[model samples]
Target: MAARETTNARTLTIALAQYAQLELSDPSAFDHFCQSVRSICEASARDGKKIDLLAFPEMHLFGTGTAGEDEANQAQLDAAVDIPQSNGGETEFIADSLPARCAELAKELGIWLIPGTFCERNPEGGIYNTAAVFSPSGELSGSYRKICPWRPYERYTPGDSFTVIDIPGKGRLGLTVCYDAWFPELSRQVAWLGADIIVNLVRTTTPDRRQELVLARATAITNQVFVASVNAAAPQGVGQSLLVDPEGEILHDSEGSDEELLIDTIDLDAVSRVRRIGTAGSNRLWEQFRPDDPEIPLPLYEGHIKPLRWQPQQH
Candidate 1:
């Protein structure tokens, strides 16, 4: 039998794929990878643990095809695919494309899927590191392009907006890619948009991954939302993927730089609980701001944090 769909909105089982990058240069290699994902879902089903959502690391689709950084960058550029823009209109996916394949996989496994970040070629010019979300029924739920690409190393064009998708049984999920987590504003804006869970896709081979774990916990605590940060395995990445609860507690961690599947069932209602009572029943950050509060000037971005507009919708 296929994996069962999540019926309860209060809780959700998620699978984080912490695997090494593969040279998916051809269709057969890509199919093999897809099959591996299917096998995992099937195994979970046999164990009576159906995963509601499965997420992979950033650039999981783009493997290091060459030895040098420049060559690897060029390989990603060469393998970049086109994604249709959703400008308040019906967004279509090209048949047999990476996104379409991911949709098919999601439908096949009967679960939500995030097949990691894809190198997307823009119609006008340049490329973006993008992540696509697919629902169980093979529909393109949403997609998020990386807003903050690692400077001086990554050549991706930054995305201008944040993306949040509402899962029927699960709560609203926000998307962030790699270095985007470094910027707290991104997570704050996403949380302000009514996201109960924030998913951060990362592919950091550098030692800075240690700091990312801290950021993940901080993001969850400040936003009062669950945070799932998935990273690539060692050699390709630092492989310290983790899940942080709304209370800023690390529920699960991959531990070291090894390929492993980190599975956990999270209480979605924990978001509402934390936001309602405050983290540890002490600091009510969200409730602290009032309607009469003054707007704080942000000279760096040439903007102000208006209290009136800063009120996030209660989950």
Candidate 2:
């Protein structure tokens, strides 16, 4: 006989993990981070809801700091993680190693995880910002290196691919790093590839936080997909991680810049519906989730766009 799906099973209970200011560099730091994640998952399970996906901030493994270009870049390179090879042969069995012990914790806690972003060292003496997803069985489900680096200061090479992972029984998952959210075309690319949920791991400075927040919502609204974003806490960023629904409504919002977890159960089925607000949401029109026509390409200048620069000292 086949098993039946439960009501709560269809809904994904996602945990947005903010850094408790934890940075992973060695086995002990990795172990502690996983321990904290285990605690959260265990507690959430006790509430009769299981956390299907747990996402960390973009720089949770590197922490926050102010250092010279060389020192800063070197710090990230030193923290870069890789998969271990065995038997002194090129035939690889397991590709990932510890210190960023995501596979270990996922297997131990029996939950899926995205270990956020870290600096990835290329064999030819370059580094790229990378992130990964692990299955409950401790297998590498998907891996992504950021295509756009934060420029001169970041000192990382850009990856040349897109990664959208398939989660069985759930929906396709897409990964995007901090600056990647600024590009609407990037979101469109991921959505066109059948991503139901796009997870953005972000770290922003205080000055540009408001603008970044707006971009986060804009990405979800434009693509009509669920976005679960995790921003670094406190000194790294504002810690205002947001979970936006397809309709561009805020489902879960974190107000403080501190270590915390925002857990919410969202209905993925709603991704296919066009929301119509009636009487302040008292009535809703459920139209087919058809995307906007591509006939009128976005490149065409529309008057609806805001001015990018200040007018020349007005007349």
Candidate 3:
């Protein structure tokens, strides 16, 4: 990844592989997805604007059209990933592992890659909707599980932690998946923890997509960080794969609901510029408030949530 020079800040070339939603009927279908990514990288190289960070959407394997795990075929879902227990490393992906394959591809293309979320088998014999970022060095740079699954009936277990990875020549890229974007706390947490850019992988459909864009932009302005909010672009998705700058200005927004890959450059140092100028972190409530300080015990959501007599559809 080459350094993209800016006025006084470092820039990064981001390529949003807004992949068409895919139903991984077999392993071959997954391979085809890899081939598509390769072709995109080849095109970039030919154009002489080689990508620094290439990000894909969330749950790209399942196609984002499934009702839930209960309705999805268990066997097919199990075959979608190879979660090697002892394979993942900061500098390497284990043999035959999903992370390994993504890392291999990233190295082949000489670009950092975020291959979106996968079903990771945990040590407890459970599965998690995990997302990983592979470096151009063929290393797994960041790994985060979806802390909040898509409402109820989501099969994967919720993750307990979030992470920010320091990409050499780029910036600290915070990682999250899917519904985590809705909760302000998650983005704020990442921002407070030294994230220059928030990379969220989403596979959203219609009706709720407008809210997704709203949250994406708001998070950027609130945190004063770049937000690479990418979503699946297919029949099952409403592909508004967006890239918002620190000022909450929409840099690249897909007008079409189809496969629209975002290839744009962003200045990572703009985040620091805003923060140092007292317009972002220095002026926020986080800077004034302390966790140890006492506050009113009033709950903004003060009531217990119990299921109603009838459940909502399209969850």
Candidate 4:
């Protein structure tokens, strides 16, 4: 008699790790950071609560400040690492070491890992803030770049690709970095590419931007995709890590103080249901509005930029 094969329906229990570690300038600091992440994942696993995905904060390994720029951009260069190309044979050499370490960790835990933006050296040797996905099989799944460059990121190169990755029965996953969450258009584009979930790993300093985070939820409803955001706790960004559902419901969140794990069970079927039904509480046609008309430029004139100079003189 031949043995029968069985198919297993896949479901994921995601854990958004909120850490409060101090950002360090020393490259040696990554060892401790890796240890912390491993300990958290392993502890959670031992509790019979296996974390399918662990989302870390943006610039979680190193600090987020720009330093030593006047001297030939050495600060950014110092943090930058050449992925898969570093001369050092140590798998833990440079920033690439973090992702490699996470991959190995994920394989050991049999879970997926999503570490937010790390400095990457491009093929041309220029630096870019990049995010990488590691599979439980210990393989690099997909990598994404921060689309919107804020502050010191103006000099960093932008990525031209929008990739949607498949995660077994979890539907398609979309990747975007820090500032990318600010643009609704980016989320729309990610949705149009058929992603069921859009994950944003961010580092923000302004806590008053709760409205902006709410706007992220609105974007999720409009795009009919679940939004999972992971951010660092204290001394880093706004520190509000959240998970917003396709219906604009806040599934989970964390305040700035606790080094917490906000876990949520995502229903992969909700993507198409909410989009197609568009019934009572799920309308999303507002997404069809276009503002690209040449005549629709802001300020209605040049007054927007130099408003103080262009102000109407005392009448």
Candidate 5:
């Protein structure tokens, strides 16, 4: 790992890797996943990539649709031990172990890592779709739960709060799960909290969700923050992963079919510049447009409008 360099806040150099395969049901496979990711990080370092942060897609360790579901495979998925705290099982919660492991990995690599979302258990035995972040020091910085879960996700509990974790090198970072990206308010709120960047960890069935990707860039531009979207590659879920800058530029992207590393450098200064200018450039306008602004009313026709096509004549 290299020392942090002083650079433009808007020009944040980010390294993104798209992972293709993950077997969530097999707990033994977790080690292999970890090794594969570490190899990517090591290779990036060797290649002299000035990677301020390294991000991987969602559910890299465990497969999706396996946990908290009523399907028969749920048992296999739950059995995969998440390394509960060794001594009394008191210090380590099964749900917290994934983030803890990620912190250890970050410490080893000495780089900021956006370990994607994982299946987590709440204290009440319910499941939550969550993402954990680790700082360069191998410390568990913070975690974010998917606020708005999609269909079938109702089975998984929604996170009650929004959290932004601060890394020493990077400023505040916000986290949002897959479907949460569809909603602009998630990113907006984080930006309002003064986040410099956002990590959108997600999984989708296919690459056709390009509209959602556009939304991601929009979120970055509107929020005036850097957004690095880490998405899983083929064989596991949809690929077409991307990392977008505060200017809504696609800094790095991976094709939909293969497993590969899409690494790029971003200048963090762009965030500051755009935000300071605070025109349409900054996300401040989002606040200007209120949800309940009486002045901004729904469109209505002052005169009677004819229908495009008349309904069938009634008897």
Candidate 6:
């Protein structure tokens, strides 16, 4: 992959599509979905505000509406695609896979796009819920597999790592799938890896979505980074896709289970300001540790949190 030119701009415009899933029975239906996405991008451009990044909810690609639970699961598994492992470098995706279509769309629209999660067939065996990120130039920037699959019900192989992508002129972004937000450690580690914003893709249909909202805000506030959590609309999901700022303020929220587009332009510099001055000029959580502070041992992870390593990467 060629290097992207850097810019000093610290602001980015994002569009979150709270989509309502439909019964897609064939490849033509999937094509229609992609066309609909194209229309959204075109409409935004016509309105004189080109979006820097556009995202959809998790499982956006596995919409088997009206199908039985068993049928839906089978369909997802059948449609599962292989995504190349980055291994800390640029990844080349299969030309005919769903990710390739997404990359083409991103390149055509000249916008960063996250078309949401896909069911992935792991080479070693088992299936995994994965999210792919595409750059404006059509590069397969990175992919993140869900580390925590909602247990018992979701029979997916959990991934062991977190992923963060640098978006050239924009800012660094961390990718997280649905249930991953429930674990604060995942978000913390992503933030510590220098993510300016965390993008959480979700497809939640249960009452727990209410609790997820609280987690979204808490994640933003605690990490002092922008949080963009997009969820599927009902009858497929519980909607309520939202964008939270570094101060944990809701910049844009759907609030209901209806299909809608949430658009916002956020100042990424606020992350630095919040971390430097403090959240509300009172809680400087990032700077709380003293120079001689002792490392705190974590028995659960069998590791220690060094005070020196507690601080997030500086932009």
166-284: candidate 5 lDDT, tens digit per residue:
55554677788878898886777777676777888867765556877898889887776778777777766677778777768777777664777777766555566555455344344
lDDT of each: 0.85, 0.71, 0.75, 0.68, 0.66, 0.86
Q: How many backbone clashes does candidate 4 have?
A: 2
All candidates: CA RMSD (Å): 4.2, 9.1, 8.1, 10.9, 10.8, 4.4
Over 1-315, each residue of candidate 2 has an lDDT whose tens digit, in order, gives 012233544467789987745553354666677677888988999998899889998867675365667876777777766643222223232334542356767878787888777676788887778887877776677778887777655777898888788777777788889888877767767776767789998876566767777887787776667898888888667888889887677889888788789999877655543333321243232232224422332354442222322111110
- Across 159-223, the per-residue lDDT of candidate 3 in tens digits comes to 99978888866678898787899999898778867788999998887678899999999998888
Candidate 2 matches the true fold with a TM-score of 0.79
Superposition-based RMSD of candidate 4 using all C-alpha atoms, in angstroms: 10.9
- TM-score for each prediction? 0.93, 0.79, 0.83, 0.77, 0.77, 0.93
Candidate 3 Cα deviation (angstroms), residue 3: 19
lDDT (tens digit, per residue) of candidate 6 on 110-161: 9889888878898887788999888888878888999999887787789988
Better of 3 and 5 by TM-score: 3
Give the Cα error of residue 4 in candidate 5, in Å.
18
* Clash numbers, per candidate: 0, 1, 0, 2, 21, 0
Clashing pairs for model 1 are: none
- Model 5, which residues run further than 4 Å from truth? 1-12, 64-69, 72-97, 278-315
- By lDDT, the candidates rank as 6, 1, 3, 2, 4, 5
Clashing pairs in 3: none
RMSD of 3: 8.1
